[model samples]
Target: MSNSRSTKLHVAIFPCFAFGHITPYLQFSNKLAKRGHRVSFLLSKGAQAKVEHLNLYPNLIHFYPLLVPSVDRLPPGAEATSDVPFPLHGHLCIAIDQTLDQVQTVLSSLKPDFIFFDFSLWMPALAHQTGSKAIYYSVITPVAQALKVPSKQKPEDMTLEDFMQLPPGYPSSSVRIKSKDFETAQLKVVANDLGTGMSIYVRITSSMIWSDAMAFRTYHEVEGPYCDYLRKHYGKPVLLTGPVLPETPATKLLDEKWTNWLCNFKQGAVVYCAFGSQNKLQKDQFQELLLGFKLCRQPFLVALSTPDGCATIEEAFPEGFEESVKGRGWVYGGWVPQTLILEHPSIGCSVTHCGYGSMLMVEELKVAVEVEREDNGWISKESLSKAIISVMGEDSEIAGLVKYNHAKLKEELTSEGMQERYLGTFIQNLQGLLD
Candidate 1:
């Protein structure tokens, strides 16, 4: 219905049911719609609210229905989506096996100019059938560009520094960033680093080799030298959209509430803890994390995925921890507005799964990116998506440092530091692209 140059440019956006999954894609959708593109967002019953809150629901043509299996195996509310995070791994084949049957019917009915695939591996056939220009959007940074991953990131226009490299492993390969000189100097420090395993190496290899183009959620100012590194390394058309996130005022108000409570705490005094939407901490393990918070005596917010499938910050917290922390701590029973919390004046640190947006938003939120998303196979599979693969890497040292150096970045996005670079680069790239 849009009567612009891109009126016929219809884009179908699909993100998983998790908060971490939907946030980045919605940011991209808003920008695309502003650019005169017709954007259609498809959601399973689970992610319906998020679509509306982020303001993408009104723009969509239809909602995809998940086939409810006859077996009462799924938890009561979780019927529409398969809670086990396996199918979303970026393999085009597996995704098709699990979702294509339903997705195919909907896509076939609504023809569009382009299909903004969610770094989903299971999209080639659908793309081919629709004859649509497939733009694979990444929620993370670009590794093929060495922009997000932790290894020896080489600069653009910089010559190869005769570094000894690790070969790409099977199933996927690793991006080995060894500094010929830095390696020699820190051989002792580097020796103790536990590197990537065989599977991670393979997954990264596949993503870098595939994916038509990448829309990473990193800013050039924030990443600076690293963003430059990505431009030179990646083969695909790389678009670095700084912290593609929804930083709403309501979200910020909640952040202020928490910040107010932290008045007793010093600047950089609280430890904001959380994991992504999908991964779960068994009640016992979840308790241990809470125990750690108690031991650290730090102000924290831990969002939890619900027993019935919806996301809740409180349900995931220890049974009665919320009542106990009412004055001193916070518990996000559902998807907490993460970006807002990190950007708050009182927030000094974060305990997180080292997710892409989680890492990027920290710049503006003025917090550090800490914690690693549990590196299980499910995460490995999704990492094949450019967004996930590019923002974070599969290297051992990089993973550790994402945690080790987090506290160092506690200052938030500086007015003049790397943060500015990320924003300037993003605005420049998005300049006319949205017009």
Candidate 2:
């Protein structure tokens, strides 16, 4: 079982048909390539185009496109989940499922040593057929994954109570879903049959059971207990990649328009809000979010998708809202350079949807505050304003504490050799598994 210490492995990554998932896989691929390994990134043709610029090491990491087969109800030429609405996502999954034979063909030809994948339950079997090892690479947090582990009971037969119950040997109780979120959690468990006759729970659990090993884009310091719980539950090794973030390209520059607009504000004076791609709020909720920024009475920039059924952000604004906040606030409907915006000196607080990854920051690291939601799961403008001010307020103790803790944790995560050490161990584990 001994492997040459200098051996360079070939790895293939096939993430789900979503930008959030695809982006992380590419980041991880960059990490692997940086370490002198070759990577074949398998994705849909359309998806490949969107993320091509992110392939930092094109020579070492190649993009291999797969043709997405036509499925009923999926928009013509829609390959990734971002191309269509949320309801049509299941059909997209069906389309991805139909590409299994095509993937098998590619894998057989490449014959990579390892194939990293998520959401494709058939990958393990195909990898075995192609003489490759399948690693279940999850972009989501281990806390969420551990919570959603499939039970012995059938998915359709599971109730809200059963869905709320934490998996046996789960490490943290505070991280469990709130009562208000139970309905959404229930749907994920019982009604997430992604048009492939397999619930999400089934897809995840099956992937875990069949994959050669499980991998995560996290470090032991952040998720050690959850990783341990998963390892014990699945009887397999769990590899950690320590948040595989690619170095920002030097050639990439922030657009001048954003730079000019942000310079109008003082240092740490602007509240920047962005809900990641795929979170389209209803028109009313979107307007409420805008009004919340107005209520905060601070300089702000909001970059969000036009709300559902709204053609433009202007039309969705509340009455007099445009004029009232014209000088100090800007609402943009298109994508902005989020990383640069966050790095900008004037940008103060970031309001986000608290996606799976950020949940750890709020719940575990205590680096951010959660905006209180109404009974119906909608965030009121007042609540949103309060949350923003709490962090941005000059005299707020919570803001000071969060900033200190966040800075301390950021230093630890970004310390010299932190990522390299984690990645080195991870690569060693990957080689060990093949031994």
Candidate 3:
């Protein structure tokens, strides 16, 4: 169990198709590699290309590419969930399942001491076949994972209102939905049901039963009770890997235009809005978010991710809306260096989709004012305005609490803090299981 050079473990990591999941798995693999362990970080050929752009330890962490088969109504070479339209994601899952035989073959050949697999339900089977200890690494929040704890009644069988309620026997009411707030309940349910043959829930619960242990990309300080609930329900050792934070963009001056624009505002005067890479806002909802920032009359920098095959960002904006808010708003269509933006002095609060990876980074710096979505995943202009005001309001108590929690969480989740507290013991435990 010691971190001895002679006792190094060879670990294989297989994350789900999404970059959100893939990115963190890579971070963990790098951590393992830094500790003198060897890692075979496996992904689809397309996903391999995506990770290559990030920091990769070539000598210690090797890449193994799996070819994803084409699915019905899904285009060829679309291995990632983000590559396809929202409705066709089910087809992507079917394609992922088809790769199981190939994965089993590869795992058998590699014969790694352990297999760290993502949320794919079919994955543990490969680990089982290869006699490798299976570990489930969840990239989502603990609350979402808690809500997913297997229930007697299927989620599809219940009403949306009923579906919003936390399954019975959960240890806390903090995440429970007494009303129609499904955000606290099943924000991920839609994606879960989008799979073709096996439902996302079915895969999740099955893996919980099959896997030797479960790991979360979260820390106990933030969701300790929920973590405890998962341990009791799944009957396994649940490990917190701390928040696997993304590396900030290397350069401070990431973009000239955005940098100059952000400088115009006073300290803590701007609202930074971004709904992660995968979330594509509809035309109406997208306009409403823009208007919401205007309504608050706060200087803002917003990154609006255009839907697949949609018109350009300029066309998507409401007629004259951009010009009206021209002096105060800076709207962008695609990728931006978010960590650098958050670090800017004018940036005050954030309005986010609460994506696991985005929230992990956002929470480490400033208070995140999360906007709730409707059934169609749209937030009204009114709701958006209220959230912007609540977080950016100078004398707001809620804003203060959010900032305090961020400071506390940042202290606990720093790279050195995490490796010393959780990941070190996590490896020791895995070694114990191996022996």
Candidate 4:
């Protein structure tokens, strides 16, 4: 280890075995590598292959593929959570758990200054054994963590009522789980007992308690109170990386097919819709969503996974869906360049499932509206159409207000030196920990 503060640090990153997790970790790695630090990214072989193209600084950021051991119920060659359905994700966690020895061996050899990880509760101990500091880096929002502060009470003892109630001294009243959504909240918060024989609550809390420091992919301006709550509860340094969005490679280009198709629409005339890769809607709900797009009567593009029980998007399409929206609507069942599409001049509004990042935009920032769901937790086509209209209608006041707010927020986030300042402070904190 070097004595000076300016000396480059070696950092290791091993996030949970999901693309949702891996993608963020890799983005963080890119930031570190951009700052002239050496980063060793520990992940499964398959995950490495899938994200190899995303490694912008291959010279400084290295991939060390861990050999995921065989586990019963985990399909052959399945290394990441995306390789199988959600229910089988537990088995993937088990496989990841089995890689602890491999990770330790690599850590010992590399002798990094710090290791950043989530989900692997045993990582802090390994880091200690290898003379490295552990940073429990959470990709989840601090607001969510603050809602369900971990307790010594076992998972079996926790009730839905327990989860519904926010933690003492919780921060925001605007960000809350409604009583109707208590069951879903409970399932996500404490009931998630993965294949490692540990609930997600226990895994995260234990990791946070043991790690040398904690980090989040957010800044204080966004979630200051929630971050403070975690810092006070855990009594550890809570560092922020801001939003570590990866810089697009100069050589990368949007696919020609997408470019050609989007060119047909006028400026700011098309609505783009996509749920995340992991979200597979039921057949009925899928058709309802497509019908909602048709009801909106606007040019739209939908890139989503095939609906459950259907082999292809075409098979699940509503009767005459293609005919009703010919030349205007396109439904694709594969990945597209999302960032590029969002930047396209032809795109006006986006309909999403409110994944972690976008949820803040809808709920807290008030830059987007959520489609109302029925008591049965299903969204009606009319509700979706109404939400789209509220944001897209030229004369609508809500549309104008949200658009102005979104533009202001975007400008602040992308302003010169904003990201640099966050990353600079983050690196200083890491060095301070070592000192």
lDDT agreement with native, every candidate: 0.48, 0.85, 0.75, 0.86
Candidate numbers sorted by lDDT from highest down: 4, 2, 3, 1
Q: What is the lDDT of candidate 4?
A: 0.86
lDDT of 1 at 36: 49
lDDT: the better of candidates 1 and 3: 3
Question: Considering lDDT, which of the candidate structures 1 and 4 is the better prediction for this target?
Answer: 4
> Best by TM-score, which number?
2
Better of 1 and 2 by lDDT: 2
Which residue segments of model 1 deviate by more than 4 Å? 1-8, 56-82, 85-96, 144-211, 220-235, 247-269, 305-327, 330-335, 355-435
- Expressed as tens digits, the lDDT of each residue in 161-198 for candidate 4 is 66666666777767656665524753564655766566
lDDT of model 3 at position 324: 94
Cα lDDT for residue 237, candidate 1: 58
Supply the global lDDT for candidate 3: 0.75
Q: Considering TM-score, which of the candidate structures 1 and 2 is the better prediction for this target? A: 2
TM-score rank order: 2, 4, 3, 1
How would you encode candidate 3's per-residue C-alpha lDDT over 1-435 as one tens digit per residue?
464535889999888888878888888887777678899888899888767856456788888899999778888779898888777878888888888888888889998988998666766777877878899888777766776665654434434444455677765554434344445344446434675755666666677777999888777876787799999887899988766566554553557777788889999899888877778877777887888888888988898788545678878887789889988988898888777789898998777765433333434334465565675456778888887777667798867777787777666667466655676777777787776
User: Which stretches of candidate 2 lie above 4 Å from their native place?
Assistant: 153-159, 181-191, 355-358
